[model samples]
Target: MSKQTDAAKEGVQQLDAAAAKVRLAELAKALGAANAAYYQDDAPDLSDAEYDALKRENAALEARFPDLKRPDSPTEQVGAAPSAGFSKITHSQRMLSLSNAFDASDVQDFVGGIRRYLGLGDNAPLPFTAEPKIDGLSLSLRYENGTLVHAATRGDGTTGENVTSNARTISDIPTTLSGAPEILEVRGEVYMSHADFAALNARQEDAGDKTFANPRNAAAGSLRQLDPAITKSRPLRFFAYAWGEVSVPLAETQTDALARLEALGFQINDRTKTCDSGEEMLAHYARIEEERADLGYDIDGVVYKVDDLSYQRRLGMRSTTPRWAIAHKFPAELAWTSLEGIDIQVGRTGALSPVARLKPVTVGGVVVSNATLHNEDYIAGRDANGAPIRNGKDIRIGDTVQIYRAGDVIPKVADVDLSKRPATAEPYAFPTACPQCESQAIREEGDAVRRCTGGLICPAQAVEKLKHFVSRAAFDIEGLGAKQVEAFHTDGWIKEPADIFTLRERFGQGLQQLKNREGWGEKSAENLFQAIEEKREIALARLIFALGIRHVGEVAAADLARHYTSWDALAETVDKAAPAATAHRAAEEAIVAERAKAADEGRRANLSAARDAAWADTQPEAKAAWDDLIGIDGIGATVAVSLVTTFQQATERASIDRLVAMLTPTAPETRATDSPVAGMTVVFTGSLEKMTRAEAKARAESLGAKVSGSVSAKTDLLVAGPGAGSKATKAAELGIETIDEDGWLALVGDG
Candidate 1:
């Protein structure tokens, strides 16, 4: 597994069945939301690498426990649902998503799996077609009587959004074809070349409009526009690779099919080739990856497919993916850049994060000028555990550092080039105090980050939170951007979220104070007021996110809002859950202390047992509340504790109460309600022999059960396996029924 994949599945290997179930639900929710944002909204939430890591993690868990896959598992789905702006078109043939291969071993395994499935020997002859997997929108074009009729995007595999009018505007797409199948559907990618994408972004900036983030996003946005004229104004290209629906076969093999498509006036990727062996295919992939930056277009990876059409048909499909094809994704891109300077930035939570300002350098076709330094330890050539990194050669101001971008992830300083370091360059000294407020900064034990102790008194933290309140994904007030928020706070006009609503009443009373201010006009000031008033009634998820709570981002906020549904409900739950959260923290602290004191594993286990026994003595009501809070899908103790701690603070609670009084927060989006385990709380303990812990959890959730990590009075069912210890005993003590793995299988019944 890759480092990123390991990060995604951290602690999952040792998780009890119940905990794994909770994690699986969290992954499913996150992946689903990310897909919708990327495919339907054209605004991705996760980087390509992050998405891939999560997908890989989910697949690994599913493989470990095949029976526990969720009904909404990302592995069993393609792209998200199509946008409602365009007409819907059900595909004549499903557009399957290809499985991914990240390493050489994975590719070898792919070949082995194919050969084994076909009952062939190791030396069996097998030819494969390798081509660039275009990082653009997937489109399927239908041609009747050798004439192009319609075009549709690959939406949810089975249905798509109709974009025939916009597709006709692309210069690369042929309006008519000759000597083609009587009824055919040509499938390929619609992309924007690098040059065209850059030029289009420049034009957009000149027009005072929002520019795209990358070539892939630009191409998707351009091709999916409702107005064909707008799409025509943009530069878009197409490459035909496969056939969807054909009255007659295109060719006997994949290589011949591409030739036939090109001969029939359809543009095909010139890099497509036929490889005789897996080693040859890997060599071809390496060559493509090497030339990827110079391709003038985006290509995330290389796609390999069975060469013979008969072989492809025999392999067929598996729900949403094809068994005959796989995409070997490129690794993170790396480049060396000079470290010009280091800057410390304070976030809303008062953590000091170091950012490395670098000389402009291109990596994977993107010009990167800044990279993340992570923390002080990282700068000192060490990890959080004080282990040596980069051979313990510390990063200096004048050193050349190798920076890497993982797909679209933020760039990070990976390694230092000691050969290019200047002799005069000295080791960097991280700040001892907050740069914005001059307050003492301290690094807590076991934490890699150094944080300021200034709390809300720190100007940076206060200003950042205010800015977050009106960010695009939050309240999104018009005329209120980061700059405006900073200026307003500096001028003492607004100190918190509640102050924004009182702006007109306090500043607009007498001589038009805001209107007369520099860079402000009557219309603009009134517009800002109007925007603020319009957002007085906001969605519960947006309101929760705008609070700038620690570890609660847009997705987590949405999850919380969906669980609680109303501000009152969430506030009440948090208030009631505080005591339980405190007790849980004490238990955790006890375990940590035991680990520090214990000399061996046996001693530590004994201490843990004693801690669990003490934890069982907690008040039942508080435990129930905590259980309810943590039982929400995609939610866990980290978020629950943060929410409770924030609410426990007197100042924070007062501010939140005031803000809640000033605005109305609507309910969250409704979820599916019909399932066998609906409203039931399930817990799993000890070892699961039949299925992996993660798989069992997902399978239970698919049947509508809320999986909890700890045994509580609220638990409806307790699934135990061999070696089940304290948790099983506790369940039995609480008069809850305990079942073996076989019993669980019988109850869930193959999910």
Candidate 2:
């Protein structure tokens, strides 16, 4: 009977091992597919929770049957294959993956294993670094002599795709580092935070383009774009996590290495902490997990790395994961919930977005009652039969939709189950007029957005705009909020940007009255006034953006400021701009006629004759003035016409004059001629030798000479750096002189 029991036990063990092998194979394949979708294609097939679950299952099976683990298992890889579109690059040192622990017990067990391996005493504590595992694409950035040379996305640990151009577009990823190592290869994650991703997706939907699923997908897509221009448009950011290959050693500990990275112009995740023991690490993981939703970015787990580099070296690594580091993933936060109704929200730009009001459900440890439907098109399952669909078919009042809370904060409608939709459900009809202002809503050609023509008159738009004006990225006026903006706008205390400056006078009469109201006091009023005073002398770029000009953003504002120098100069430029010849005659007849005669036989003959007669022979004084105006960079035919047309309006001109009178503007600093290729017309094409194309362009711009996107006849000296392809040929055709890196350096007196 005992021998029979032993045989049964052996059979059970064999069955379990066989099942574990099959599970490991399945997990490996699933993980590989998910990785391909996430990294190579910039499209994820599985939810964050589902992906983590699969990964966890794979890890468990691998632990049970360590001998059956495959070399190409997802557990053994750093990242997926290199994206085909980007140039392939091999890393100097292979990027290793981390082992994982899910809970406090798991963490304690891991620490125990480490102590046993090190032969330390039973109660001995290990110092470690606990940091949020940013859910973004892993990348390696190489620097030579304090300047960024190249950037690559992690692909299968040993090899990666070169994303130098896209990486350069990230504002936080510095082109040149300060106090940097002689040669450094810093590893980090490129990501778009939740807020930025939402905003980006919103813009993309409004522009009638495909929207990203989440921040991770958006960051991956943006980073892998072939054209740097596309990447520049996305709000992608980077956070340094670890080192790849370095000429000079960093610090003795992981925490010190982080400090060094921060000092060298790399942005490190702010949620990193040092722990004296595994218990402290577990505590930190709990605290961060609790505060996860409040954070603007997505973090799937917490990473605990051995602080001491020497200790880490001693621990070494397994064939796959590092022995000194482990990832403590938070539990999955997704759950099924019923969709109750759909509501539409009007944004500051008058974009009407559909939102799903769901039966409250807990996902990722947070209660979610609402999910963003994105737009009308998203509501409907099909595209326009023939015509371009504006908004997706409006989501009906009642429909069963799959809801997901990414990072336990942003609730988004993932899918709709038409089978469960009510039989009585009717197609939702989008409003043709502004709900708040009764203004006509117009969907412009080639635009998906339907905006109200009421402008600042709409209460919803006005309040939102006012809030944006005082937002941290804008004027940053203290003591002002969405509620306060609405209150002030409702009371007629402020009407436009200029009204913000006049708030003291307009609200002075009601100042004492406001102080008497709830949540208002003398000190509060004084603080508000002081805050407003502080913003009176804002930078030219901020002032331009705060005005909320159509189609103008931070980058555009910066460009305008750099070109015009001050508020007055920019006002003069924009106002003096005439209308383009192609503009509607009724809208710009006078301005267009003033600039150029109509295309008629007699007019063409007269213009030709005037040109042949030379500047001295015909309108010499006017010619000199026109030449002076046209010579300015960024001032072209379209811009010049727009400026002239604006200035022609008496009301617009008066407003500009008033704004200029009330404000003081500062001049931008001139470039220094110390760097190589300074003051040279550098046209970067194909590839680069020393830096990313963006870094080279930025360097050239800072030094002086104009940086034109296309090679032109007027190009004085084209610095034909490495990767000089079509532009180099164009320069030769135009008889534009060209130089290599050494020649460019000599010209700039930096050789």
Candidate 3:
């Protein structure tokens, strides 16, 4: 080696852990801020080469001081914070970021890393698939029993924005898939074609409207539109190359899995190929890079993944990236911009999300104007974990912000030019009240969000909830949409959910019928009524979810419905759980009163006594119900609280009762015939290392078992993971059989 190169290596080797740690900390902070600017704000502060060099430095430092590596290291992250425009979706399994390979040596190192991690020799040839990495938004499309239910974006790995409505508008995405698993999450890239992008921009320019910079940005902006019709009007495509949660394995190898996705009517990239060695993978990458422009869509680089699924499982994952895969990303471009203003938007859950509005600046071809501010803490210059960011520098209006866009990625704030900061700038104040309804907003303990407590009266929450109720996964009544629901609510024809079912009866007299209303015809009015009547018989799971319980999503509702089987059973159980809910609220009041009068220990003792007294007042039936609801595998005290509190409220109950009176809730379906675990009420707690919690529940249900979220008197078994909590103690108290992951897997017979 050259003297200079040898000296650099020797210098790195001479550094002790303590000194290395200092450098590592600096590298981590710098790298993190740079990434946030690139990924979150689409405003890159550093050039591509500079960013890569910083990452390399961080990786080398971590190698020197392995123990000093923080869990939030930028090397492990994939995407930026999800934009708050739509409802947020949490993935069952984490969507990991990929390790990057910059050049041929990097690609060689990637293969070598996998081999070394798996204890394979240099001579051993492991097959890998090299596919063109489409530079577009990543999406996860979930299906249940061969039917496409929803689609979500890859927002910060664990959670993303729900784009199910706009996704449904894409002709390339299948609404139904026959011969698919009972549960499947097919992951892929969603992008627009070159020709389509040009046409869209042309139309925009002609209409004197905002035009997109590239196909990727066009695809992202269009797909995220609140109006599905707009997305449908634009031409977009998808290429399924991977997956997340699944009921059954798709294929033994990556190539076969891609074939399976294609057979299921998904579009897979045609240029994808399997390579047996590093050299072959590099050759494929070269070919793709050479032909990228002619592919009709944008592809930034080549992605190489281990062909064997078994090897992938064995290799597993690090903090952010999987050991079995790497993405050879193209270089990034950067630009400068000015921070104009910040705005707050309230979601259905009453979360006040802050958005950064920027002065239009061209970055990587896209005209970027706004980016995700994430939360109040972010604006105040703090990380999610409360760490000071950019030396604790707060983002303010009138500051010159750096920005960048790569492929279809959103433009993000890369960094701030402190020299350009204005003296008149003031710290952005996060609102303490809902922006829409002016209700007092509150951020719960251990939560970053400040939620508005005006559930019944808040216009934003009420409207979003109503829209979700008529959404495809819920009631899915024909002719009812977001606009229609808003209109009905405004016209006093529909107020609460129950009013949707009563529309015809209230407004259908000869002269007063909906047919006589403006924009209404006799045939259309009759069709809507028939549609409403047809939906009178709904599934229990759908009904439960349509209620818009805070913690009860489609999966949770399914878990509850399957455990109870019948609507009346669930209602009665929730009603019985009400006493516990009342006890909880009473305990809260007692704790506050006791704390004011006593020391810590005395307060604790008094609180325990008050809770015991409240429980003693609860009827035996109510106590049993509370225990049972809490006994479900996923149901916790918080979820139980939401359910019981909603059920016990007079107004809530009146609306629910009216809806139930008007419709019949059919029993949730289960596949229990001739299965050993069929009819078994099971609760899974803690973490299951073998499969995701969702996957475990799905497997158990496929064998005819009823998986409940919590532990209760009716629970037959508890599948406890490591560090099992109160549920484990309760299971012992209830004398319910408890098993570990291995025991549970053995009982279900992993297939």
Candidate 4:
């Protein structure tokens, strides 16, 4: 062959090789993104078929060219990297992920492995804590001096982002703990309830704002917001499951710690149980899976952790997961339904979101007719050819859409069939104005949302706000709920939350008559009134959050409460503070001046500092007027702004005044340090020398010294008796102080 011809052929071969590599890289990227979305975000960007196709292609490519596999390849990782917006915080004790088992055979294999690792006989019992694998963001909250000081998101298991400010927004997360240790770091998941998610989406639709794909995605997105104000707007809740760093030991068993978390006002998952054997654990998982659809929140699987800490220690860990724990995941529930039509929904925030009207199909025992379309881009598939797809392509009016009902009760459109689209079907045009309020709708720069200008006047927004005020995580008024709130509002029994407190007096005589009329009774009415009375002395944080103020959440309320000390003080300051227009004008002028003086040495920095200092000074004075009045902890400027804005109207102020008159603020709990074991760190090892594990834990807790299972340096005394194993040796090696059964008895004065 000629030399020129050979060179040309070689060049063509190289070009083909490069193109193949590019295709492989694209496949890998797509697979990784899909996995991250499904696992971390709880919002799958692709259907199972599409994802499986990509995975197969990627696997084939990797096999064809093993050298091309990158170090950060999707196949090598268990989960996605930690989010970047949060601050990195290294855990005192590594928070390990769990190994997953998909089927009964897998569960049997896992149990077999555990048996082999522990060297147990064929019928040896293996105790475990079977808990729901909450499909939400994992976080760690630290409390100091009986007060929450920091909250962090689980990043890479070892380190996390500091989201204390945002975490405070969850009402269930206490600002100041009761019966808490000097230093307590508890880990848990933050989630949104199905009811709240529905209301929030409805409000979003009413206001023409984009709706979240699912409750889990809504929760993750909310918790990850850099601005606490934004996070506060979301209906988020927390349920603690583990502990990290602690000054005092928590409890002898994992179950005890869960109870302690609950006593300290931290929410604990109610479904957790201590199983005596792997069989019991499996049974519990089966029971939970059967009732998973009825649960108020999303849960993907069940987590089984070794109940005996000593057994867990012996098993140790491997890489990112502890051998002591395993996740038992149920099969994903997917169904195929015809996409009959597309609908536009306006939200409370005024963003317009698309909804897929589907043929009613039973999924996990519930009939689902509609699924969230997410956004315009999502509906159009954001593709070049505009092929029918749910996640990556548009769904026509008559296309078949694959729907999946994961942990979330709501089904989401997973994929669309282009071939099934009717030829007469036309592209869906999203609405340009609010359907309810007929307000001008606009999409802002860099945002994927189209929002309406309408505010509180919209019926949907009003109902949603009312529901938020009485929500379980907010005011927690026992008898009032979405249905009741809607009924009262429609009947004029309550126009606002404050009006609720006055219903008894305004209609007391008529109440009895109304009770006798229909769907009411003397007992029910009395129960409701009692429930209302019970909430009269709620903490300032709850009260502030219950006001239904925009952008004011639990954390912000706590910050404002701490800063101002009193509601009256905050109200007056907000009333007198400069308006948003004034603040904007001042900022504009300051920016112009700074730009003009940019040439001056260090002038920009100095000017910026001065402006910041001035703003801070003004904020404290105003914030103090309100937060200091309430004596609540953790209330900040953002919360103050929300409170002020909510109470700005004369009607709102009057309602607040009435609420204040009917309510009496309770005194904050005082921190206690009077327990006999207050300063001691006690570890319970071996089959308890004297009492049952539960009895020993309770006794240790009563004495004030925290009781832990594993021995660590911080542990002051190791209470060893019978069956003491590796912990005793580790304690001895660390030179940690040890105490025997008799010594423990003498310390507690029971000798």
Candidate 5:
């Protein structure tokens, strides 16, 4: 299996604090190494898709928990530092990266967000230029007095490596330009055509030298050579679409600017078009994606930019990406491969996930060796709903399966080709017991996965839980990584989270001391101990996330922490809400049973009545407590049930208590107190003029207000705009305070 496939097994959503932290560190190290290998050494370590997936995963985690963002975060950095062999040239303007849009909705959001930020109406004439995003190295050519002065590669965005002589050697790049500004910096991509790249590789292979991986790598390697003669020998091309540090404005719009560059003897993509609406931009993007294979050069996606220079300037930029533009990336590529075997791997949650070991095959430049089987239902040609899939074709060993990979998501089997299935292959029988611990692996009703009943006794679960407890966003012991956790668990040195705190007192001076262990010494062991000691005091949110409660992810943990303020308050609330949560679960189960019986009898059942009857016996106090728990912003019944159920387990509760006793958890950061909307439940509806719904919610949350999706008695304020519908009417009927967009702006002091 590829390293990427191995890493993708642990989905980001399934990762606990520790696992996420460990994975984040791994991604950072891997991506940084890949960047250095690709940018500096011109030897790519990871495929483009794999690299993009890693970057996406890292960005997703950072977005989820901004507080846990690393100092060496790849999202903040552009490329590896300029290679030492080349002279560094600081860019007159930073060459920014465009944020990616993986789907149609993302592109819509990009356009919508810009419109919202600019306070423009939906029908406003917001023209955008859509063009293919070339998959190659970015180059900046500086021209003074219409004469080419220097050329540089976008090494780290701000500072680049000088490649002026090599740039001059490329026939497409003119040494002198006519009808150009006194000082014009033309920025574009440097690439090699597919045919040229193939020929070049053939020549290198015939000469017994290292062949390039792809056209991009070949272009990068050929251009960055110390000898310009080597670059001249290679067929390279340039496409100018942007400019930097121009003495005078090239044009009033992005379309005109590109046209100006083309007029100045630089080539721009002929497929570029000026789109007037989001729909038009997406249409152009689809066209480009459809024509990508025949484009004769590699293009990853389509770039969309606000055409108006004034609007672009007003949109400005984030830390790394411009707000006025985005790269609408192509969808996942598919390929056919033989499924050699299926292996069941248990996760931290005891989920028996089946992984397909495939005969390695390249899918859009990325080599696929493993793909997720999802569940037994998936392998049996059924979906989670027990509906037929792939025309009821079951996947078996030695079957030809179609695999697909999307942004950051693991590769999955899309379909099975029965025509190619081996005649000798038999149906796969999923294991009924935990492969590691021999415990009963039971598939619960309404769940697709078969979970092991071993709990903590299962080595897989124990070690995984322990790893989560010490993950970076959790306790974050410096030297205690996933490997160390496994080693300690195997050696019977640490079995639980609490055992970590007692390590020094129990074994520091004894013969079984960690320092005396193999591969350990005075310095390394001391550092581990110091790291553990440093985490004796931690934030409440981290502590909550470290517990590894089901459905209680980093974001949920933060919401819980912010709502409860302290550990004691959170524990007390859970204790009070447990009975109600359990009752609710009972009600749900009762409804499910009724529906099952009704289905068996070929009759309909009143599931709502069944649920009400089951929940009717709950005490009033328990019900009230449960309501309060779920009432917290971003907290729902699902998270509340998980929290309550986790605390209801005596053994687990005791373990948590023991861990808590050895440490002090700081209170969650307090929100703004003096704001008018502080402690209020605000719901936004209809056409917000000044800001988008997301912007409004974020603004409200930042000012200590709870932003709810629906209007109810609990809603204190309703910020309604034009075209306000049922929500506004409901708010008025509920007697909640109603305000227009202007009133809301005035209330928030933004007007």
Candidate 6:
């Protein structure tokens, strides 16, 4: 949100009472509609950026013309009105929202304001506690005499929905407490993890149910379910950050009080640290932002609270937010850049993903020049569900677009600014032909991706597939790099992956002469040949990953290799079982679509019966292989379809046959039984003083431990380093053993 943009709406020139009055009227209408969409419909039409802009414009207008301010001004409001679907619960104390600071200057102003409010000198020590602000639904849980009682959502600050039964389903909330006050109100956030959200969406798709757009929405929708059983089925976590009402004070400081809450069996984010200065607080925020992607959950900002309870009481509450605390949010991580060009890059699966090449601009410390356009629909201003994105504004070649990244390594186009759109810009017409081979590109029904139908014939997909086959995580030949692969491909020296192995015999004695080539000498060419020969035998998992199957990532490839152990067994099973698996998948999809469209109960019942019949028609001969494939954890229908369908393709099959003939795939490495951490699940958080995470994970695997990316009940040990946050706290709550780097080394005999 920029001053220049809002200037036209409620610009500085509109300081007059008459102009302010008109601007106030516009703000009221816009805010009302946004509130209705957010609270009542649970579908927001405006982004947070837009909503914040509306509020700021209203505030600026009211500030200039206080006498002319309307009675329905947004300045006096808190949360939106409570949803009528649920019974409301009145709060004993107001559950006010926090004021937000989007930049360093806003944060400095906040510190200065608190100092001035308390009449403290510039040199006075004003300690503050900084905690990661979880982006989820705010909840208040009330307890009486150490017994769990009721819970409510933050509906309208004063009144909230009574969701006691639904809140009981959250494992983080204790049913009882000890050594506590007669009555206590614990305020926190309820959230869903990224992994859980993905799993829930998968389950929803399988059951033909509606899926949510993000984790926050999923958590809200799941917790607000009418049936408690439904809420119980969703994996929701909680963190106790603040309190609403208490019979007695828990501690003198915010940091100490959080410890008290943890002692009472409530979850606390361990990243909460006390800072003596505002600069340190900002630095802590930067650290959190750096580790944001690995947090396992979503957080939009870091909150700074006056650590001293006595000082907090002095600077009390404003109309809608507390004077003692403020949320310092990360910058939108968005930047406006010219759309230099739109290039179609075909993936190994032949999906044509439109990538926007932008004029280089820095966003959140990274210079980003490319952003994902998602699909053709996205370029035309539509989302996966055909809903208007960027307010129905389409992107053009010369248009300036706003791109943003939320912990994702790859940035995405958030919106297109039509105001700066060039007059010469024409509507981007997405090509229906493959950019590489000129093959027809088609979009499958129920999927948003448009794919090239050229299979192995398309040069883009072919080159990518070959590159993936020999990359670091795949075959990993010593002398083979992307540049070498392209050179070999363009010269017709290698059309398939197997050609690399036969290069010496075919070209070593040719008239072209190995020593006479550009950028290649006799020694280098011989070294390349020897390197390829040395890799004649490779790991089975690496080979599986090298096939470039859709949905078969490195982990999935490893899981499959661990299950099947041998190439012949896995290949033969998938080849023979693909037909039955493919048929069952087709039937399942049809049944789900039909059930979704069925208007009457009788029609839905008929569709259910058809689904049952479809299951019954599956061939028992191929059932075991299909069942085994799906039985592997995380290897669901989506993965099964990809793995099997690739093998089922005649062209793909021929390509794989060529690669397989040139290499002998070996089994996974045997673990050391004598190691103490054998058969254990370990996770490493924060930076290690002596080694990298990759080294730690590799060592753990060599010692027979399974290194997982997240902390769960199954996690046997957590190696916490400095700045360990949510994972450390969750591990402590779950009673997982924690150790330092030295302890880890000792366990592995290195110490």
- Per-prediction TM-score: 0.65, 0.50, 0.59, 0.45, 0.69, 0.49
Candidate 6, overall lDDT?
0.76
* Candidate 2 lDDT trough over 10 residues, lowest sum: 4-13
Predict model 3's lDDT versus the native. 0.74
Instruction: Tell how far residue 460 is off in model 1, in angstroms.
Output: 1.8
Give the winner by TM-score. Answer: 5
Cα lDDT computed for each candidate against the true fold: 0.78, 0.66, 0.74, 0.64, 0.80, 0.76
Residue 185's lDDT in candidate 6:
96
Which ranges in model 2 have alpha carbons more than 4 Å from their true place?
1-334, 383-394, 407-410, 507-511, 575-578, 581-660, 669-690, 702-706, 710-717, 721-738, 748-751
Report the poorest 10 consecutive residues by lDDT, candidate 6: 5-14
- Which of candidates 3 and 6 reaches a greater TM-score? 3
Q: State the displacement of the C-alpha of residue 669, model 6, in Å, after optimal TM-score superposition.
A: 2.4
The sequence of per-residue lDDT tens digits that candidate 1 reaches over residues 608-699 is 67577647767776777888788765678988999999999998889889999999899854433465456567888888876667667767
Give per-residue CA lDDT, model 6, range 662-682, as digits (tens). 888998775886889887778
Best by lDDT: 5
Residue 338, candidate 4: how far off, in angstroms? Answer: 2.0
Model 5 C-alpha lDDT per residue in residues 575-664, reported as the tens digit of each score: 988889988888988988999999999999989888888888888878867876887766898889989988988888888999999999
Rank order (by lDDT, best first): 5, 1, 6, 3, 2, 4
If candidate 5 were superposed on the true structure by all CA atoms, what would the RMSD be? 8.3
Error of 5 at 269 (Å): 9.1
Better of 3 and 5 by lDDT: 5
